[model samples]
Target: MEGGVMKEEGNRLAKEQRLRKAVYNAIITLSECIVETTTLQRTLNNLDQSSWMEVVEERYLGRMCGFPLCTNPVQVKNAQKYRIDLKNKKVFERSAEIDKFCCRSCFLRSAAVRAQLEAEPLWIRGDEQVKIFDLNAENVRQQQQDTYDVEFVEDQQLITSLEILKIGDTAESDDEDNDDETNMDEEKKDDAHKEFYNLCQSYLTMKSAVASIDEIANDPTVKRITDETVTKMEIEAERKDNKRLSESEKLARIRSKYSQNKFKRPPEIIEAKPFNSELCDKVPENLYQDFKRILSEWCGPETICHLQLHRRMNLSDSENKTVTEAKSIIAQFYAGDRSINKIVEDVFLPPVDNVDQAKQRISVLVELLKPSWRLLERTLNRNGCGQQALEIISTFRLSATNVILEKKMCDLAVAVIFRLLAYCDRSLMDFYPSDHIVSSKFMKYLEQIRCDAKCYFGILSIITNKLE
Candidate 1:
């Protein structure tokens, strides 16, 4: 008994060791499988980060076959795939490389349904069939030969009966006497004559009424002038007569009444003597005569004499110095002096607060200088004084710097310079070369002035081109 018990214990020990070994092997195998699966999962996740991998996932992963009644997952498996051509009503087998339905049964089922639909007659679901049947019945009834034949036969019978009745009535009328017929015809003629006479009377009365209406319509005096129109005409006529008489009679009466006054000679007139010699000597000797002439032309002799007398009275006081300076400048310029810089300094340097007033003053001076400049140009050209003309132009060009600071003065200066250039081109080109010293100086001054202000760049360009 002891030996059996020991053997049983040993057997139990061996069974326990075997069971433990099996359990340990199972645990190791499960751990290795888990590590392999995790590594594969990490690899798949890394691949899914790429765009093409995502497309592959969408193409195959979690996508089912696009086939009717198909529940199989689309994959590279044992099933044959196909594509259904709905337009051609055909089914074609596709390679496993293509992404489409996975099963041939689905394609075949779809094709069978398409063929069945094609084999069936075209169907209308509303009352179209009933209406078509009714139309066909109506057409068949119209096409039956008996229906129209019967209607035509009845019409012919009715027409024959009407003709027979008309013949019988004619025969009965023929049985009557010709005298009765003649009496009836005479009665009809009398009635016709009476009606015609009545119609003729009515026509004549209507024609007379129409003629009277036309006469009334054709009357010229229908639209007589209103009282207002007649009054206006009378007023106009009276205005004309009054104007004629007033003009003629007023002139005649004035001539008759003031004839002595018109012909009367004034009391013996005393002419004022010329300006005092001391005052005349104040102007330069060469310019005195021209100054006196210009002063007389600009201001009358009486005014000039008054200015001279005033100057003489205030000889020591510089109160009205501008008037004297203006007189001297004008005199000097007209006397063939081209000292425009000094003239501008004297005339244009006095600052004016009012721009409009300054512009007005500049405009007045420009107008006054224009005639002198024109006369000078003519005299210089006639005497062939092209160099003197250029000197005068240079003086004006230097003066334009001060003038161009004002907008209006700049525009006027541009116009005057353009005119001067034209005059020089016409009158002085024969004497001077294209790139003469005067022309170069003038162009340089023009470029300088143009740079200083934004004025007449176009005209400057044109002048430069012409000079070049």
Candidate 2:
């Protein structure tokens, strides 16, 4: 009886010890689960920089209250106004009509309800009840048959080992057979355990590889870095495209600026005449007589003697020849009563050896005619012969080219030209062609000379005013 009691006590102690071990293991597993859950929550919070309160406010603002049993608006109000310390929680009160919660009470109640719903296990939720169905008789039988098959396989292995052992033993005793079968069964269990351990190790290795892949794929830092790199590449490409467009536009503008009037042709030559018939018709009898008197004085014997002395002193061989030819032509025009057109065409338009000869002949003519320029200007202005005077001056100016003039001569020429232009009709000025003195190229050349002279000239102001 004591032995039976001791045996019962031993069995009860072993059962109690086993139960204690299972409870300890359960506690450890629960603790580990809680740690894992907290770690996952922290990781998620770190990834999203916004606090839970801000997230909730952003999601629920201007929307209906989240509480299942309440109907209220949500609004963003000053957090300090709330009586509850909502810094660690997500709660807000109404300050306007658009608020989700009508009051602080409603917000708190909603939050509590949300927390309760989150805490409740899915299996215990009334709305999401899970119904477990029992296995049918055929399924139970199939499962049992599979278990029996596995046992049979193990037993077969044991039996084969026993048979091998028996072949090495000479004993035919039943006790020895039992012992050998037991040893074979133990060896088969050990082999099964080793196979299970190997399978578990392989499974753990595969799980670790999958977990590393997930970490690489889901890391926020990696994703953000990739996004920044793509944005930089796009920005660089855009800048390059903009730079290319700017360069093309700059080149186009430069071409347009320089080539604006480059291809324009020089003006055509017209019939030449010494006196304008239009001026003769407009001039009063008194002004016409004054003009003739001035012309006679300009061609008088004293002026002729001074010009001959000037030619002897300053004229080259070619220049003296040109001047002599010009004098003969003028004498023929006056003595033979030839038309002014014939004299201008034959005398002024004839080719010369060089620009210097042409210039010297022009200087001699200008010197001889200097006394008449002022008289011509006054007569034209008084008699409304401004257009005729301008035309005559422009023709004379065009006849002289590629010759550097003395400052005094250039000033005299510019002054005369400007005085004529000032009184002339603008329409008649435009009628003068491009190669004439009124053209852009001729005006620009005058401008360059004015700049070099640096002394202020009335011509500069006149030209600027006319151009503007």
Candidate 3:
């Protein structure tokens, strides 16, 4: 019976020891888990920097009804004004086991509250330039670079091993596939895998390149150097400005010193000569008088009357006196004893005796008229009575003695006639070769008559048509 009791006691002792060990292990594990949880929670809460706060239960001597947290001096002051006992000191200092770990939810709540209180709204001030945060393509590119760098550091060895394994697998697979069809299938799969691998490598290479770029972009030393360079450049620019001003002043002084005297020398005095050595000597005295007499006689009053007739008589107001008087003047010059009425009847009046004869005569005149119509055109253009002058010139056929100005009148007449013929009456083309009227003979005569007065449109038309 004693032996059975001893065996039972030994078994009970072994069971108790096992149970105690299990409880101790569970306690240690729980404590360690709590510590790890607190650490993780603190990190997530962004409270790696935190101060310890002790919680205490105090008994107030006065009537403080509820537990109100006295956060600030104002709260305490208010509580004191309400006659409430606000105790910040510990009342009972007794040792008690208490949990000292970060409450995951409480830590997050505190962090959020702190963040809310600390965060400032993005705002533009009236007097201050706001810092512009550009979170555009450059920011995203930088973020991508950071992510790639981390991924590469974490998986570089793994990727290299994976490649080795893939190559071995491919070799084995190739060896196992002996049939042509199976070999082709394996080759296609290998090619697909190679393409995938190459794509991955390309992505990694691109990512690595981007990361290196970011490293350069974010390098503080490079930024400092750039800022220093800009500062020096600004200083140098100011120096250059000052130097330029100094140089300008120096140049101004130099110019002032040299400009005291006039740079230009006085021109040499030159005596005026009476006449040139090559100038022609005087002409004979009688020759000058003869020339004057010829001019006076040729352009005298009778010539003026004849030229007026060429310019046409506006005898609607003169009882035909202008035509009659012009004929009388010419007769007076031509014949010593000729009656004005006879001279008029012979020269001024048309050869036709009646209206029927006049119409026939007009027909004959139109048929016999040369392009010397330019005479009236010139006389009319000069004297401002073009239509009447043209009628007179077209109608009258003066004698050679009376036609002293015939050449000028005829040349002017023919030029204007060509101008009219070139463009005016297309119907008259049957009667005259309009093309022949613009001939060199006609244009040369116009040049000799009109002098510097250019026939621009007429000349252009002639040149263009001839070239064509």
Candidate 4:
């Protein structure tokens, strides 16, 4: 009884399984028919260089492939496992496997070709559009420029108005204020320019050591070739000299006969007497002192002579004061008695025999001038003898050695130095030694006179005039 029941159950189960299989087959067949008629598969004739396409090899299984030959699961159409034989260009849609053939890759290539063709028109259209846009943009830019030119003056006026409004809010609204500051700056610059001009002018005034500078520029003779060229020329010259020398060998042989002649040898040393303190003592004390003082006192308004004299005499400050007092007494004596021209003549061309005599002459000159200058000042109201008197006073200051002389000498030295500076060449100013005592003293004198740029420049002009 159990065997019959079990056999019946197995038969029923088998029938049910067969029925399920038949139904699944029918559904697949209908799906294949639907896909075949739907025209879902496409062929591309002009594939673009870069595009994506899918090639179907099987339906329902979703088997596909692509160019450069890739396979993935894809759907098939027409109840066929579509396969591509790419070399043949034939589409096979069936459930049969073909040798060395892929449906997908061929379809993909066709699709890509079709896509490339389709996109060509769109790319051409885009490029044309860009060109048209560029032309329009250029036209617009030109129109804008024309418009700007038409309204240029108005625009400038508007800008000026805006600037004026902005300026009104600032502290520096006054144009004159700006002008004043500008003038100040210009004045400063002018002063500097004048100084430079004065320097150049002064150089022009003075005698130029480089007198041949311009001639050197213009002269063809000045330019020379290289040393090697000169050497070559010399060699050629030597060759020419040697051409004559060959014939002179006979003369040379004649001269060789006298070569044995010789001259005398002289003694190396000679002796003389030694000592002479008595002769040294023969130099008179007053003479020595007087001789020294001329250079010390008489260098025309420059106290450099006096300062140098003191230094050379090696006198202490106290001794210098005594010397100065004695000198003043001599100057005063000459001033009360002597004539100005006589003093002037005496100061420069002193008796050269003794220092005391020279001192006496210098004293007479200074003394004669001092009171005469004062008298000239009093007498010459309309005439310009005051200038001569001033000059005389300057000369007197150099010789006189009192407290008054120190200040007066300093002032006079300054005047003389400045006056001389005007006559100095520009190159000298640029290259002369600043460390030199005379130069330093001269500059110090300029500072003392409070000489400004214009005054110095006037002096320069005077110098240039003299030179011209």
Candidate 5:
């Protein structure tokens, strides 16, 4: 009885399992029919040079592949860009527009063709022939400019010819083989020679040397050193031309030299205390001293040294005192002490109607940063700065970015940005922020008050002038 019952139970279980399998198969078959009826897949044409497509930059992640015909999953490891390309027509739903291609084949087949982009971008192209022609012309012009020149600017830099250097570089080339090394054209070489000649000629106005056995006894550009000054009297006294002179006389001379050198050496400089009746007597000595101490805290000691704010270096006593007064005035301005005119008469401290008076206040600082501004301008205009520039005329000033609707000013701002990368590479201008308020770039533009300085300042003076 137990065998018969167990067999009947096994047969019922088997029938039920078979019925479940048949239902599962039916559902899968219906789903496959639905997919075949509703969907279409087009076989891609072979990718050739003429049919080649390039992926644009700025790929993004999406739930579905961006390619209109593709249904593949996007892999995180591979970045792909997609765009519709066939006849430049975009029929994909807006939601699917951002979806990127899952595979390289989809990208190659659907992305805008590199050749067709010259005619017009695939997604934006229309049946408008006029716009298409205009774009093609522009692209052709751009293609012409794609070739880059690899020439160096330093090649054009004027080398000082040590040969005939004192006489100046003439129309002659001394080295016959140097013709191969020379990089400049005829016009550039001529200009370089002219510039070098002019620099040498500037020293013509200097006075002749004093009569002395010393080779450079009175060199003006150089400070003579015995070290400092070997006096004419000392030079002459040291000469022992008469060998017959008594031993007592020679001993006396030696004794005199020892005593004089120890107790009464000649002064290197004539010392005089400067006293200006108008300026020095009225300056706030106590307040200015306090300002210098505070200045170091605010501006750091290095700034004081770089700008010579602590004391104007390399000036005569009278000039030194005058420059100290000017620096004090600048310090006062920095300290927000606007009543500088009350402290030092006839000298204005900003907020002045007279432009010259404004310039006079900061004349001392301009003499410091003229070289940095020069480097910025020259580097911007150089050949290998990675800029496709024919003309760049303006200062790299932050203030000029405020011009409203002026095309010329707009061009200048763009030029500054365009040249910035090149400027960073080549310019000697400091990129790091200056530590103190006094040495900051905001305070750049102290200028030389000479004809050469004026010529060099040129357009940049517009920015530097305000700093002065």
Candidate 6:
């Protein structure tokens, strides 16, 4: 971020330098034109350092197109002569222009006599004057950086260093007064405690605090520490604070502070994970699948699927209602969510312009599968009809493949193969300890064909022959 800021600042400085050079040359030429140098100089002089940017920016910084209507800048070493059509009065020059004239010939419109401009160049010596203008532009920038300006007044009343030292030193020594068996005289400690307690109660009510302060100010029991009493060895303590309070008043202040400390004590510290530069990408398999895994770990029993959206108009009431309900689902599927499959389908088979097929062809064999699937499963379990069932299944697959029907027709073909296998109580995804068939490779073949579910469904059906 610092490098980016420095680069931006450097670019700005370079641009400013370029603009300053142009403006200087323009100013020198202007001073020569009228035989006077003070008008712009006066404008520069009147401008405050913080406000001169507007004057610098308002000055034209580059050579512009000579064609009257166009204010576009000219970058070429030699600008082309301006050409215009007589009838329409449109200037012609090329700098990424897009117009009706650019696309085609304009021979129909008559050409006009070209306008010419002539000006003699004059050299001048005005560096001292223009240098000041450049410096003022820089000054405008520097003036913006001075953000802090308010000077705070220092409090200089007598808060001597020994008082601050006393506040710290009392931490250990003051605890002795709270105990009954302390060596300090019992009456003296009780008297000090009573004075501190009364001071606290008066301060809390604050009604007679001023009067009490006046009466207690002259109390001889208050041991005063004067400038001479605070020895040279304790002079370092003076630097902490300049206030010098009497011993009795300091004890009251310490009791008051300790009473308040209980309410403002900070909360317990919590352990935080340390910053780590090395990041581990746990799933190198797939990004989309990894995203689902991460969210699954975070949410656990509460399952969620990603639903990305793009720029769109307001959804209809029906769509919004359905989407919200689907988003709230807690149960997840192993394969993928419905939306992921839909997106994959769209990518692999983008909808053609006019080829959004309305319906699939209903072959007679395809029609028969709806009812015959169960009946075929029953008969194929017996001996003779096994090859017959296989032939019928193959015929259905070939017909559908040749016709190029939609995905559902292909799925119906796979259903036939699974039904016979199920009738015999064989299955995939389950392990029956005594059963021979626990899983099938047919599902894998179907996936390899991207779930088109090929119509070759009858190859794996079991046949049992009874010996007579």
* Candidate number with the higher TM-score (1 or 2): 2
Candidate 4 residue lDDT tens string, 255-325: 88786678779878867778886664342334323422432344432333322332333333343244465
Candidate 1 stretches with Cα past 4 Å from truth are 1-266, 271-361, 377-427, 431-468
The C-alpha local distance difference test score for the whole of candidate 5 amounts to: 0.36
| lDDT (Cα, tens digit) per residue for candidate 2, span 1-468 | 999999998987776665445434323332221224333232221211122233334335435442323344544555565445467776665354225565665555434323322233222222332222221334444555786784323445445555645534535544456765545566755775676566557755876676776698689998999899999999999778667677778678568767566676889999777887556334233432342233332232322332333323333433224446676556555544333343344445545665554346546555543444444435334333333343333233223332333433433444444433443333324423532234443344434433222222333333334333
Model 1 lDDT at residue 178: 58
TM-score of each: 0.14, 0.15, 0.15, 0.14, 0.14, 0.15
Alpha-carbon lDDT of model 4? 0.41
Counting clashing residue pairs in each candidate, in order, gives: 0, 7, 3, 25, 5, 7
Candidate 6, 317: how far from true, in Å?
37
lDDT tens readout by residue for model 3, 1-468: 999999998987776665445434323332221234333232222211111111111101122211112111111222222233358543443332111112233333333323322132111111212222221334544655786784334567546646755767767766777664353556756776787678678766876676777698689998999899999999999777667677778678668767577778889999987886334322233432342233333232333344333323232343334356667566556645333234234445445455443335434434333434544334334223233333333333344343333333334333433343323223223323454343344444445444322433433333234323
Q: What residue pairs are clashing in model 6?
A: 159-242, 159-243, 160-241, 160-242, 160-243, 161-238, 161-241
Task: Write down the TM-score for model 1.
Answer: 0.14
Give candidate 3's whole-model lDDT.
0.40
Q: What local distance difference test score does each model get? A: 0.42, 0.43, 0.40, 0.41, 0.36, 0.36
Q: How close is candidate 2 to the true structure, as a TM-score?
A: 0.15
For residues 208-276, write the lDDT of model 5, one tens digit per residue: 333353545466545545434557656666564436578898888678766555566787997897977
In model 4, what lDDT does residue 255 have? 81
By summed lDDT, which 10 consecutive residues of candidate 3 come out lowest? 52-61
Model 2 bad stretches (over 4 Å): 1-214, 217-385, 397-414, 417-468
What TM-score does candidate 6 get on C-alpha atoms?
0.15
